[model samples]
Target: MTEPTSRSAPADQTQKEGSVVMQLMKHGKEVGVPSNELSSANAAADQKGQPTLEIRKDYMYRSTGRPEKTDMIKSLLTDQDASRNCELYLSASSNCSAVESSEDSEEDMYRDAEEIEREKILLCETSSSEHKVSVAPETDIMEYCRKEWRGSTPVAIRMRKGYEAVAQKFASIRRVRGDNYCALRATLFQALSQTTQLPSWLRSEDFTMLPENLLSKYDWIKQWQLKHRLGRKMGEISDEIKEYLMLLRKKWKNISEIKGPVEKQEACDKLFKNEEEEYSLYEALKFLMLNTAIELYNDDKDGRRVPVFSWLLFARDTSSNPCQLMHNHLNHIGHSGGLEQVEMFLLAYALQHTIQVYRLYKYSTDEFITLYPNDPEEDWPVVTLITEDDRHYNIPVRMCQETVL
Candidate 1:
């Protein structure tokens, strides 16, 4: 990380010009770098004796005695509350030796904000147009159930009725791996199946060329580049998110372009089963979830009222400072443990889509189907999933299955 620049004048003659020169800062005082060696920029309002702001070439900040300038500059560039929270997060991350040590592994890389900015994928020029839903073609429900259970237990036989019941209303079950990341995987599967333009919804205005008011209500992006600075490595966090989004868009388009359902499934299998693809998606999901939590926490803290995301705050050992809890969440990425209901709700909101989960229990009530966010602001695309135990999720592909009258 480059040292922060200083704000001192060489002489009264230079000071009268209202220009600020960059100087090496150390221990709260300017030193070392010669004034002539540093670059100079004239302040717009120098004649009025107002300090001109100079944008830092990079986002790294060092802990120093002079915090007021840093605070002021960040306040101008980002949401005030989010900026403060991100500072604590970055500070904590910079000191975590474990995080810094994981730079060698491809799965545990951390990226700098400047790097992300440089490689940022421009939104497709035609992305502004409406996206069509590339619905996953239906498959045989009984065949899917048989393949899933493999005649392993008597309970599996009884569950067939519930699967049939689901089949009556839907087309087929798009199976998801029964892992800790099932919910996220299931959601992404259904979401991507719906459209190849998922990036249009997921990319933050801060990171992409998006309109400010576009989906502003559900937009969870806020100083995310800073919040997601998990490691101190130069380029450890190589934009897994950008890579993941581009690949998904490509894969969805590839699947949609296919002529047959079987061929489409084969294409999906190729992408979904790839260990590298799964890891990239998981990392991207973790990054999005972590930053979303920070945005919500900052909102709640700023409002000082009944917490909107109180469900997420409770049920966890916060240890007082919520930021520490967030830090713990960041550390747990790529580790064991499934995402919680609050997180699913957050993901649903983040995607601006409704997640409908259907229970595959032998006996269930009207609550067999549940919707995240209860009420949505728009007619967002619906992503359907089926869960036998509710702990894991699988996409339910709708198709033209003939119903037995």
Candidate 2:
């Protein structure tokens, strides 16, 4: 027979086909298919002039026993160029998959972090809303005392007896709400009560007490009114302070003019019970204290003496500078509950009244009374303050015909 006419693809087509074969062999090796089987598939495809894809599928599904086909496969595996190209292709593909997976992981991490931040913000807001201080109402001292005495101990018996004696002295016991402002509130309440009892003649600016004024009032008001003057002279007092003083004067006049004892009491209760007016009065009292402190500082400087204010200031903090101390104590929002014994003395001198504090202990009712001025002459028009704990003050209504200041 005539030599079978050799048939082959064009050189270019043959090169492309070779490349495809090489790729198939590389893929088969990666997927754990035997090299001999891949070689068999390729050689069989060449012999039959069949498609590479059909041969590969056939070889993959059905194992090959053709030993003669292995030479081409061994040659392809040993070829350095083919091995390098296959490795490079596989490495590039693996890198692309790794990059995409890393990007996806990075995205997941960011999403988790953002979710955590949102939770933190929500938690802080919830905490702030929960901790806000609620308004406290004034309550009876006996109710508190009853709770105290209910405990059947020796201390309880002593406390019960002491409070009973106090209760008999006063018609009623009204506790000032315990806060930084308690002492000031109790003192002001007593002052206002005393102010209400004063005759319009004595309340006037004339600084003169008539025979009629004297007849109407106790000897104490005569002295208290005569001594009472503005914390600073007229020129030195600021307009803002003037307004506060005038407002207080107006409150005194309005309360004094009220018809009956019950109505007057209601008016006073309403003023203190309302938070708005209560804080306004606190502002006034604080400003007054600051003003007094400033005047005292200036006077001390002029006299060329070591200031008592400086001593108190240095004792409390580093700076003995009056202005620095005043700014720190008065202007700071967080500096609540700083009104000390010295400041109480300042308030007493500023208001021109004696702040008499009668302290009751947990164990005993033995009165620990303190007067701000500590004058030998126990002054009338005194603000009678009672405290169970020395920190907070309350008003005890005196039983006598004399109105409690």
Candidate 3:
């Protein structure tokens, strides 16, 4: 194969950099370009007693003496007076040598410019990640288990179940791929492993789907309707959440374009903003879950089957919708939306069973920190916990641990 070659730089300013400028620089304070030849901006600045050149710190102090102006040759050579600027060329270097030198200098400059542009593009991508939900390339589930652990290692969940002991104490990790609602999916699968009321859609072999995808599950949604004490009709709840999925689907295309905190906040607002015709996506889910939890309560008050969504109720008035203030349970982020943690806590609290959270991390040690909600008498209501991560990590589920095919 032919060797890769560098792109040629423009044969102008870049070529002039280390040539005549170097000769003038070597001459120290002697060879001075006429100050009149400076650019008008520089001329105006110089007349007002300002420094003529914005130069490097080392370039500021020359060998001989502190000159009134630095990089004078650079300014003069770059101006329109090209022919007059040739006087500073070194006599030792022939015209042919100078031409060759200029070519190399041009090539080097071009490479530097390319590198800078690459860095700028990378910076833009990094900054824009707030709104862009990145989906990794699809990988086989089997490959996930066989592959050697790289980057962030997956954490096995810790929960006590007499039947299975949470997947034989984390014997395997099944990676969930190709979806935005990963955290929600993972949590639901793990937390609801023992629940007899799990919807068939959740257990289907190919059922990796979001809440919006569940619009057809009438029976599952019925649970939502029966449990909701707010008495919101099931039809209304279904329509609101369907609209949310529609917005998110369209946004998958536009999200890459979103950048900065402001745009991200706007996107989140759009997800939560209810217009004249309908409620925001967030509001829709809030109400849907509201009804579902109510249904669970009515079904079996002693079982504490569903999450305590009444915690979402606001008896007092607020500036905004009371629903927005109930975001304390947890904030969902990842594939689509998530609430397995909040759901688990609500179910556990209702059933009078304690839930333990393992915030696994691979820092100086290969271990996880356990988290428990504070006592009811604390400043906050049920629980107030914050987990910080300085690095990336993985979470494995307890619901159904299967080997890759």
Off by over 4 Å in 2: 1-144, 152-158, 197-243, 304-315, 318-321, 332-335, 362-367, 376-380, 398-405
Those runs of model 3 whose alpha carbons end farther than 4 Å from true positions after fitting are: 1-168, 178-180, 196-235, 238-321, 325-356, 362-405
Cα deviation of 212 in candidate 2 (Å)? 38
TM-score, cand. 3: 0.26
- Write model 2 residue lDDT over 1-405, tens digit each, in one string: 111111222333433333333432342222121112234434333222222221111111113211111111212234334433332111001122232343344334333454445545744764565332222233455665774345444545556666775665665676565545677788888777656454332255621222223224323212211111346453322334445545665676788778776677768877776665566566566655544555555544454232222233333331234444444444421133334444566677556678877656432412245566444123345777776544467787745355342
Of candidates 3 and 2, the better by TM-score:
2
Residue lDDT tens for model 3, 180-256: 23333233223222232323222343222333344353334423321122455545554555555454334433433
- TM-score, predicted candidate 1 vs. hidden true structure: 0.50
- Model 2: lDDT equals 0.45
Candidate 1: tens digits of C-alpha lDDT, residues 1-405 = 111112222333332221111111111010111111112221112111122222221222234211111221211223323322212111111112222222212111223343333323322322343112122235577777754544423445546767877777776665555545677777876665555343444433343212122124334332223223345443322343445545544565566667675665566666666666655666566555544454555544453221122322322333123344444444443343455444556676556677877766423554456566444334577777887754567776655563221
Question: Where is model 1 more than 4 Å wrong at Cα?
Answer: 1-139, 143-161, 196-199, 203-205, 208-234, 238-267, 304-315, 318-334, 400-405
Top-scoring candidate (TM-score)? 1
TM agreement with the true structure for every prediction: 0.50, 0.49, 0.26
Lowest summed lDDT across 10 adjacent residues in model 2 is found at 87-96
